[model samples]
Target chain A: MQEILQYLFSGITNGAIYAVIAIGFSMLYNSTELINFAHGEFVMLGSLCMVTFFGSMHLPLVPAIILTITCVALAGLVFERLAIRSVKHPEPIVLIIITVGASIFLRGIGMIIWGKDAYSIPSFSSHPPLDIAGAKLLSQSIWIIAIFLVAAVGLQLFYKKTLTGKAMEANAISKRAAWIVGIPSKLMVMMAFGLSTAMGGLAGVIIAPITMSSYDMGTMLGLKGFCAAMLGGLGSLWGALIGGFLLGILEALGVGFVSSGLKDATAFLLLLFILYVRPGGIISSADVNRF
Target chain B: MLLVKRYRSMMMILSVLAIACLLVASPAISASGKKPYKIGGIFAVTGPASFLGDPEKKSMEMVVDQINAKGGIDGHMLEAVIYDTEGDPSKAVMGVSKLINKDNVIAIIGPSRTPTTLAVMPMIQKAKIPFISCAAGNKIVQPIDPWVFKTAQSDILAVAAIYENLKSKNIKKIGIISVNNAFGESGKEQLLSQAPAFGLAVSKSETYGAKDTDMTAQLTKIRQDNPEAIVCWGTNPGPAVLAKNIQQLGLDIPLYQSHGVASPKFIELAGSAAEGIMLPTGKILVAALLPDSDPQKEVLNAYTSEYEKKYKSSVSGFGGYAYDAVKILAAALKNSNGDKEKIREALENTNGYVGVSGIFNFSKTDHNGLSPEAFVMVKIQDSTWKLLQ
Candidate 1:
């Protein structure tokens, strides 16, 4: 029973990370109507930037977080202006390919800057596992869960309360209508890119202390996050959170009960199963059906 | 005047061509008719396995410089042509082809990682060039490709070293958590094959992926079995994370890691969790702990001092593999008259050659040329390795 609990805690903890990544993906897709493939590289950028700023340069954690997220957010803005915006009437497929190119380009730049060694940062509060009823949860796992909730809640508030959020949603609903209504649709799209990239950077800062940081880390995290986003509901923030958790928990449980070697495969397999059953994700099914 | 100008331009072109030929042939001419012997090296000097390849390349270069400084083999300059594999097998294959086809190297050294070295073995054997590998996989030399030899001690020998240490502790049951790759898989094979002979039982076996950050799930599984010791087989970061996870779970059993985590990089990654975790590796890590009477002491100390003095970093075990390979190849070069077949024969018949890894005694059947004695049982103490008695 305790063993099961341990697995459950880890599964949930892992799912939370995937949730954060999925949220980043969901936000960009929500506003742009184009899936940003380079979304994963933002995660890499976040981690590498943190490692450089915090680990190498000896910046304190709080400032490092702000600086890294801000830097990645600015990168996102540049990516929008330079790569995405440069394209005239690009197909969604073309935008995705460009994002992928952006991802690869970022990875190459990261390699040149950081080289290939896996750089690790000490935890924000490095402590031993909190043992409860024989279940050990890493202190970092606790921090991960807490930060994930804060980000999720903060994003929810941003969407529900902020003027910028409503305008972005209005643009997503119909860019022409939003532009005609003086919502500045172009700014909303650029804001979406910046916000989404910052979210990825935040995931990097939170997770790097646990997984260690490397230039190549973004692809897998991005892929899993994409699966979570797809599973939860495309372009639905709440759906992304749910999807990320489900995938994370399932993968952890699969590794624990099933074959350890097939741990990565189990998540993808669950993705295929979920997608087969619910063509439209749990949250977006209503909106998808109406469309 | 036009005819005279044309003849003058033609003479100028001929003289320029003559100078180019002389410049190209200068080394051959200066060596008194003995052309410089070219050696090709392929190391993953800039990728995931840079920890291994960077040191290997640097050490080989240092050895080559020292040898040339003393004057080349029989007065023929030794030229080293190196390529970076970047830990990719395709690059390794390309490197081998380029060396054999374009560089026309008499011999080749390294590919660093086991998979990369294995990927190029068939090609090197088919090309019939003398190739010495620095990887630790037993399969690399077990079938014994005539042209291939490896200087790094094999996984089977590493297992023996571990078992010998376990016997001293009177611990019989063990668990293994290996990363699913060539190095880890090979270590698993050897551990399973050799355990029963040592009166040991593998109680539980689990594996983690290369990119896995957490091994607590595997460690938790191992914890249920409650083995006397747990062996973690992998390279840095993963094994380092495993060490931390083991500590995090507070699993009290002694953790034994493979030689793949021999470098100080592992200690830095694992932090305080690295303390008291034992592993079997080349004596290079604990060279200072070795007595003066040790045969490898002289070579090990010389290498350690020279490398540290040059790189301003302590020498790692990975570098020792290349250092040993170059020295043995240099020895083989001395006896073989620059003939590839004769060099192969000379390397095969190498007897009582003391190297940093071990006293290498190569035979027709044995290509690795080092035994279990090559590995020293070591435990991390206060962020540094201490040799176990």
Candidate 2:
């Protein structure tokens, strides 16, 4: 029972991180009809930049983090201008291929900058594990979960209150309609890419203390996050949150109850089961086609 | 129409003649005295395992430069053809083919990580080129492939070393958490097979994937088993994550790592969590700390100093693996004078060649040439390796 509880806690912590990545995927899919496959590289750049600017350059953590996010956001913008915008007309498959190419390009650049070493980010706190009943949770994990919640809520509020966020939503509804209303749909798509990457970067910096940062770190993680996004119905934000946790918990339980080797398999198998049951995601309803 | 047919036939004849001319000139160019004894290197100079490959490349380059400066092998300038495998098996295949077919290398040095070494060894053996590996895996040398030799001690030696220490502590039951890769799988096989011989039992074993970010779930399962110690087998990032997860869980068991994580990069990635984790590794790590009378001390010391001085960076055990491999290859080269068959025979008969790793003694049956004595168990103390008594 204690072991079960322990796995549960760890699962949630990991789920939160995956949720963060999935949310970025969901956000981009929400505003722009295309998914940025380079989303994971944004995460990699965030933590790698922090390791350089914050850890190596010995800057204050706050400014280092800010600059890291700005760098990652700019990287996302570059991907947009160079790869996405250059496509005269893009099908979904074409967009995916372009974004994956951008991902590889970013990874190559990361290799040059970081020299293929796995680097670490020191945790925000050095305290011992907080014992929740019989299960122990790292304070860094708590920070991860808290940060995920804050980001989710903050995004929610921004989408509801801000004009730019509304414009993004308008573009998502119909690009032609948004352009007719003078919303500048193309800029909205670019901003969605930028905002999504910023969120992904934040996730990377926060979780990198636990998972060390490397140049190719984003490939598998991006795959998993994409899984969570697809499971949650790509068009739904809340679906991403629930789907991330679901994938994380199922994977953890698989490790605990079933074979540890089958954790990834178990998660994918569950996705298959869910897809069989509901074409839309767990939180996704029949009418959740809008942003 | 007749003119066009005549022109096409002439072009085809010219192309065939060109190909025949190139093929006819290849052997004469390769056999020349100026065409130095070529050695090809396939290391993961960039990508996930660059920590291992990058160092190996630098060490090989250093060794090559030193050998040439002292005057080339048998007065023939030594030429090295190196290809970056990027830790991929297919890249290793590509590189090895190019070396054998194009570069005309008589010897192949490394494909730094275990899987790449395994992938390319059979090819080298078939080609009858003397292949020396720098990775640790018993399977690399197990079947007695006559053409292949390894510098780094095998995983069998690592398992024995860890079991030796565990026996001293009187620990009977053990747990293992190995990554799901060739290196970890090989380590797990040795640890399980060798445990019973040393009066130990593997109680529970868990595994993680290559890119797993969190190991808490697996570690938690291992913790529940309540074994004497948990042996984590993997390379960087995975094992480092294990250290952090173990620290976070406050698991009180003594952690033992495989030689795979026996480098400063492990400590750097693991951070404070690395404190007190013990592992068996090559003496390159503790060369400075070795007593004067130690057999490996002088060679390790000289190699580390020269490498550190040349590269302007700290030496790693991975680099020492390549350094040892090249030393053995150079010894064989000196004995055979770059004859491929003679080099293979010479490498097979090598005896008491003191390398940075250990004293190598190759024989008809044993290509690995080192034993359990090659490994020195060290513990991470204050974020650096300390020789465990």
Candidate 3:
């Protein structure tokens, strides 16, 4: 049905954002063995970066976006080196607490810097709604989906083809082994953190025009991304993709068929159900524990 | 011996003079003139609810500045002490206690959200200090405590306006989407309980949390019900998310929302989808939709211009309510000459006090100043609200 198609397309667009954020979460979890709860704050900082350098200063979109990503990536490096590196050998719970503390600290700093106001980024294109088979889709949605797909494919190729990418994989598997094999494990972990933060920043920039930007915007997105990552089996990149898209479509369908108020609860309930049936997520069990 | 005696006497005199100066400058010794009338403001100044409180704080600051510029009330400068409730209720009770017992404020202005107001109500009643709530929940003013009054219209009045508008449009079936919080629950109760009386049927109901982003699954189910209208009742960001999801799902039916979505940020967040969405609000907002010659025009214009100049942004109904609250408080102060009991009586006896929002007629039974008649339906046109007939 036309309504079904609309929900599907909208779901994909929203799913793309979740997918992008989840990719970062996946990379950080794989390499550092830390959940990086502050990963969401990186996205928020990226959006705030746009507001500061572009929105307030009226810079061109391209340079503004580049500056935002660079700033966010650098912030991730500083966070990892200063806050995360010290707790690398601590209890896993301590690492989680540290990341959560980082998240709160970043949120507080953002509030003080930006104040509490919502801001929007201008859409990249001025095209009218694209109608296909009784379904209407905005040009912005296409941009978001395209950017997400390109980033995913690009990351895949980088990991498969580049020497640095293999080093990160080795580092993720066993840091002591990677160091014995001359992999420079610490640098690989730092690189993984940088790449993940950049991806989050890019997601922030791409979605800013659609959802607008606010200090608290990243918290919900972060939770949804974590859910998507878990649904896909956190260790599998492809699973993250499928899980994110599936979750998005399910939410869209829930809102379309059920009440809007129950949409979130439905998504969470679906997540619980998925976990019950497939404890390793939608992905195969072999891939679940691969990391 | 005579010289030594003279020098010793001079040094003692100097020391006594220095001690005398310190005593005169101390707070305890300077309490001779009329004591400053302290007014406490409990607001959500630092959290998610800061958006509502920041403007109210600015308005109060402006009002206080103007009042003092004209040489304080009854020759005593008004002192406004504030407590940041952080939009939490338990903290609000503590805030009330601190304001009443420690700061000794004669009156308190708010604990902005509904739950916070409800939490602090007991403390206010126990202390018998006049407290005016700035929140829109009708339940805040009910059971009409003699010391409690509200500057904003109630949720019941807002729902009644929407119901009447639905009738005018001949839309009979409506789906309801609300948050799980106190504000949303109260709205849900009002709509479900009062819709039958207005000849509207509840087609479906959905609920979401404050932090939810995706609501498509719920929207899809509601679409299956094929309701004529979707009535969303929640604060900002929630309603905006619903609007985006509704548009994305291609549910083109009329989306009727609570007054909370009247902010420009809602339109910005909802994007082009915000167009044609209908909501009911007080006259202070959507003022341009009213006739130019209306008596309330001057007040609206003055508030709009002054607020824009002061805050560098457009004014919302929340700011208008704060403006009106200050005016009402000033009127009471003028009448009672800073007598707390007499001011409470004057506030309780407030009748026909024309404000930008509506004509406030507070009585012993009703603490909310406005009725359903005070609202007008407005639709978003090009990111701005236009009156809908």
Candidate 4:
């Protein structure tokens, strides 16, 4: 029972990280219908920026975090302005390729600035593990799960309750109609990129202390988050959360119960099975029915 | 007048071409008027394994510089042509092909990781070029690939070193976790195969992905069997993450790491979690702490000081592999006299050559040229290495 609880905690912690990254993917995908393969690099930027601000520059935690998020969001805005806006044809495939190119470019720049060594940031508050029924939970894990919940709930409220959020969703549905309604569709697209990258940055800062940060850290993460997003149903906020958690829990349980060598294989095989059955993903099908 | 006006432009062009030729040829023409011997270096200088390649490249460059400073190897200057493999097998193949065909290097020094070394091995053997790899894999030198040799202590030796340490503590049961990559797979194989001879029982052997973020589940699973100690085999970040995961789980078993995480970067990445972790490593890290009676003390000190002074960073055992490779090649070069086959034969006959890693004694059947004595076990304490007795 304690072992199960421990696996659950591990799964939930990893799930939160994946959810954060998955939301970043879903946000941009919803607004622009573009996958934004470079979304992971934004997370990389966030973590490395925090490493510079908090670790090297010795800024206090809150200020370093804010600075890191702002810097990465600005990078996202600049990336959208430069790479996405300048594309002669904004075909989804073409834009996806451009983001892929942007990821390589950003990674190169990161390498030049930071080199290849992994850098760690101190946790926000250092404390001994909290014992809950004999399962150990790091204080930082609580912070990560809390942030994940906050991002999900907050983004959910923004999309459903606020005018700008609804406007963004409207822009997503029909760009022509939204433009006719004076919704400023271009601004919404740019805002989606900004908001999405800001979330990515948040994930980076929170997780860096645990995972450590390097230039190429985002490559596998971005791929994993994309899988999570696909598993939960792309463009669905709650779906992303459930998908991320499910994937994390499954992976942890898989690692624990099954062979550890097949950990990733287990998660991916489940995803393939789910995709074969549902086609639109676990949550996206519900979303499609509403449309 | 017309002839003079037309000829003036021609004279300018001729002068420019002549200067370019001299500029290109100047380095090739050494002080002794002898051609420089081009040495090809393939290192993963800018990737996940950059820790290994970065230092290897710098050390090779440092060795080349030191050799050239000493009036060349028997009046023939040594020139290093290094290509970054980025830890990719295909990239290594491309780099080695270019080195063999385009660079026309007399001998090659590296392709820093085992997989890259293996990827380029068949080509090296076919090219008949004397290749000295800086990667640690028994396969690189085992079964005697004549043209292929390696400088780093093989995985079997490192495994023997680790097993010796475990035996000292009388740790009978061990859990093994390794990253599922060439380096980790090789170490895992050695760890499993060599266990029986040491009277150790392997309990719960697990593997994690190279880029895995957490190992709690693996550790949690390993905890069920209740091993006396756990051994993790991987390079930085993975092992570092595993350390943090172990700390979070509060599993109190002694954690043993492979030499893959032997650098100070491992400590920095792992933070306080790195405390008390033991690993077998090349002697360079604890060079200053070595006793005067140690045979490798002088050579290790000289290389460490030179490298630290030049690079403005601490020297790693990984870098020492390249340093030894270059030194070994330089020894062979002195007698080879620009002949590739002679270089091969000379490398085969090298004996009692004290290097930063160890005193290498090469032969026809044994190309790795170092014994298990090449490794010394060290423990991390207070964020620094404590040389174990």
Q: Per-residue CA lDDT of candidate 2, range B1-389, in tens?
A: 65665565455446545643532212111233554788888888877888888899888888887887777778776667778888899989988999999888989998887888888877886899999988778788888898988888888889889999999999999999999988888888888889989999898888899788898999888877689999998988899999989888888889999888877889999988899999999888888888999888888888988988998988888888888888788888885777899999889989998898888999988988997888999999988889987
- Which candidate comes out best when scored by lDDT? 4
Identify the superior model by TM-score, candidate 1 or candidate 2. 2
DockQ, candidate 1, vs. native dimer:
0.23
Question: Quick one: ranking by DockQ, best first?
Answer: 2, 4, 1, 3
TM-score of each: 0.91, 0.93, 0.86, 0.95
- Against the reference, the lDDT scores of all candidates come to 0.84, 0.85, 0.79, 0.88
Interface RMSD values for the candidates, listed in order? 10.9, 9.1, 13.8, 9.3
TM-score of chain A of 2: 0.96
Q: Tell me how each candidate scores on DockQ against the true complex.
A: 0.23, 0.36, 0.19, 0.35
Maximum-DockQ candidate? 2
lDDT of 4 by residue, B1-389 (tens): 54664465355446545643432212222344688899999999888889999899999999889998998898888888888888999999998898899989999999899999999999998999999999998898888888998989988988999889999899999999999999999999999999999999998899999877778888989999999999999998899999998988888889999989888899999999999999998888888788999999999989988998998988899899999999999999995788999999999999999998888999998998899888899999999999988
Q: State the weakest 10-residue window (summed lDDT) of model 4 chain A.
A: A282-291
Clash totals, every prediction: 0, 0, 24, 0
Error of 3 at B247 (Å): 5.0
**How far does residue A206 in candidate 3 sit from its true spot (Å)?**
3.1
True contacts reproduced, candidate 4: 0.65
Worst 10 residues of 4 chain B by lDDT: B21-30
Q: Residue-wise lDDT of candidate 4 within A1-291, one digit each (tens)?
A: 988998899899899999899989988888888999998898899999999999999999889999999999999999887678666568999899879877877887788789888998777888888999988888989989887777778888888899998999899887999999899988999999999999999988888888879999999889889999999998877778888999999999999888899999999999999999988789974565211
Error of model 1, residue B24, in angstroms: 24
- Sorted into a CAPRI-style docking class, model 1 comes out as acceptable
At residue B143, candidate 4 shows an lDDT of: 80
